[model samples]
Target: MRAAHIELTPTEDDRRIARYAAAAIALSVVEAAIPMPLPGVKPGLANIITLVVLARYGWRDAVWVSLLRVVAGSLLLGQFLAPGFFLSLAGALASLAALGLAMHLPARWFGPVSQSLVAAFAHIAGQLAVARLWLVPHDGLIAIVPFFALAALLFGLANGLAAAKLLEDAGRTRQ
Candidate 1:
């Protein structure tokens, strides 16, 4: 039996999504290098890309980029199929769900900053839930919620600001 030849064609939108996913993966790699004070408290730099993609493209494309980042980032970081990978996957799913709802809010009231804040919290909540139910299985795990929430708030705000600035610059350059 001969192997079948395969042809793949990528549209502009596909290329755009790939580029965004690659950028997010790059950010994840860089984030993994940074030493974190807490185990799960690294700055989510890739989320900035997710927020930008969500704003510019849509939730579908954002989902593609976010999920692609989680999978590819895990493979690159040697965490594929590990507990960390599942945690990351759970967080991405939660964040995407939140973004899906948030994107529907009035544009004047909720932009990238507000959306990012919401997604960040959802991301942490998903991770905590997974850790509690699957990894830790201990009631004491709830005690760390405050610390993670603070980190999520701070990092989400910073990432949101960065994304907003990028969007602003992109808008200017389009003129």
Candidate 2:
């Protein structure tokens, strides 16, 4: 007879994971409040929380945190189902995938800043693709890629540095 796979229920430690997820979501909301000159652009400070969760809690929990952030952020901003919401959702999902893949890479090969750059680039690319394919459906929008790339690189570096610093501090405390 073949054995079926069984999933185990959460223990006390699992509750901690849930708490981390909640914290990540809350951080995202707070990050949303900080404004930039551009309307749609953001520093993505919340990514620091996501990165911490991914490094500590694992990818599955990180995903839950990210999804909750997107949903809650949209509702809070009163832009649910709007183009901005879709763009944010796409960017978040893309960043999650990039971060997941980066986590599996050898630690020496990629550090926090590099991982953040890759994830940021992926997020921008994903949103642009969505815009071209579904939202705009016109070639004129392609012109914005260079600007977005520049912004993503700058903000991504900042976010990556912040996350790396947080991680370093956390490690120091643990030691």
Candidate 3:
């Protein structure tokens, strides 16, 4: 009997996946650059990239990409440990969970639009819960939920449309 050795090689698909992840990270940075009037609120344009990654690569990759985006984005913004950063982190985690659940759903049950909507809602709920429990002791922040939820709806739709377009393009290229 002879000992066997194995070496790994990067296939074309692996290279493509790496490129996609890089593109998603870059998109996340750009999304973080956009400013909103309210504090700790964002359209989370990077989520579109996460959604596309989830649809194409699956849940694990999406979670990794999303976590990377949140951590890197927070560092880049110099917001590490700030309330906003924690809020964003909470939202990202919730969004990842929601996306994972959505991926497990029947294909016909929820399209990208509905998936994004649900994820956005979950993200908001998570952030609100964290804010109430850890950041703010009083219920003053509760008043903003409706406004944030409305914004989430609009931004979620936009993110979903962008993700859908990206997925369509990726599918076409694959074919």
Candidate 4:
């Protein structure tokens, strides 16, 4: 049987999204290289990109960036379809869901900082749930919550501020 050949071409929008996704993936690889004092306590610098995309583009675009970061990042790290990938995917989906809802809030009251914090907490919750149910399955895992929460709060706020600055710079450059 002759093998059917299928060719797919990327549109301009696809190319744009690919650029953003590549940026996010780069951050992910860099984050993975950094040594962490505590498990799952990295600063999540990649998420700052997500926040910017969400504000400038939309939630759907942000979701694409986040999902691509997880899948492609994991593949680059040679951890595709592994336990870590699953946890990361779960965390990303949770954060995206929170961002989706948070975007509906008033922009004045709920800016990038608020949205970042919300996503960070949601990410931790999702990862913890997966860790408890699938990875460890022990009550002791709950003990890590307070620490993770604190990390999420601090990193989330910092990432939010960074994203805000990036957005501001982009706006200025565009003008």
Candidate 5:
């Protein structure tokens, strides 16, 4: 018996997405190295890439980049299929939903900063919900909301500003 052989051709978009995903994954690794004051309070540097992609490309490409980051980052960090993986998955899904909605807002009014803030809150909310329902299963989980919210605000704003700068630079380079 002979097995079937298949070949897939790569499109320009596929190469672009792969490049973005690689950058995100690299950033995730760097983020993992930073010392965090709290367990789930990394700066989420990779999300800057997501925001940039969202602004420049579109939500669909952004989604692909974001999910690839989560999956590939988890695998790289040796957390695939673990509780942490699920938590990350939930947060990414929630963030993507928020981005999808936020993208529809007026571009002049709600740029990367506002969109990042919205997605950040949604990301933390989704993680908390998963932790409460599955990991802790106690009302005690509520105590961490304020902390996470603060982190979300600070990190979201920072990432958004960075993305905006990158976008600005990219635009300059293109012209």
Candidate 6:
């Protein structure tokens, strides 16, 4: 029996996805290098790319870029098949889902700031839930929820502001 051969054609959309995913993965790697004083207090720099992609493209492309980042970042960081990978995947999925819903809100009222904030909170929620079900499996873990939420809020706000500025800059470049 011969193995089946398949060829895929790359389109402009595929190139766009590659560019966005590269940016996300690069941010993730850079963030990993930063020393965190606490366990769940990451600045979530990679998520800024997600917010920008979601705003510029749509949820579908945003989701693709997010998942690709988790997978590729894990492999690059040598965390593949580790607990960190699972946590990252869970958080990405949750955030993407949040972005899907957030995208429906009035774009005028809810821009990158709102979307980024929502995704950040949702990311923490997913990670906590995963920890509850898998890692610690302790009700006491809930005690740390407030801290993570606060971190998420701060980082999300920062990322959202950065994304907004990037979008603004890109708009200027296009003109």
lDDT top scorer = 1
- Between which residue pairs do clashes occur in model 6? none
Candidate 2 to truth, TM: 0.84
lDDT of each: 0.95, 0.82, 0.82, 0.92, 0.94, 0.92
Report, for all candidates in order, the number of backbone clashes: 0, 0, 0, 0, 0, 0
* Candidate 6 Cα deviation (angstroms), residue 118: 0.4
**Candidate 4 TM-score to native:** 0.95
The regions of model 3 sitting more than 4 angstroms off are: 1-18
Q: What is the C-alpha lDDT profile of model 1 across 114-175, one tens digit per residue? A: 99899999999999999999999999998989999999999999998999999999999999
Candidate 1 regions exceeding 4 Å error are 1-3
TM-score of each: 0.97, 0.84, 0.84, 0.95, 0.97, 0.95
Q: Model 2, which residues run further than 4 Å from truth?
A: 1-14
Q: What is residue 162's positional error in candidate 2, in angstroms?
A: 0.8
True-structure RMSD, every candidate: 1.3, 5.4, 4.3, 1.8, 1.3, 1.8
Off by over 4 Å in 5: 1-3
Model 4 lDDT, full chain set: 0.92
lDDT digits (tens) for residues 46-106 of candidate 5? 8999999999899999999999999999999999999999899999999999999999999
**Worst window of 10 by summed lDDT in candidate 6:** 36-45
- What is the C-alpha local distance difference test score of candidate 1? 0.95
Per-residue lDDT tens digits of candidate 2, residues 44-146? 7777778777887788877877777778777877879999889988998999999989888888877788878888898888888888899989999878888
Output the lDDT of residue 109, model 6: 81
- Candidate 4, residue 156: Cα displacement in angstroms equals 0.2
Q: How displaced is residue 45 in candidate 6, in Å?
A: 0.8
Residue 131's lDDT within candidate 4 is 90
Candidate 2 clashing pairs? none
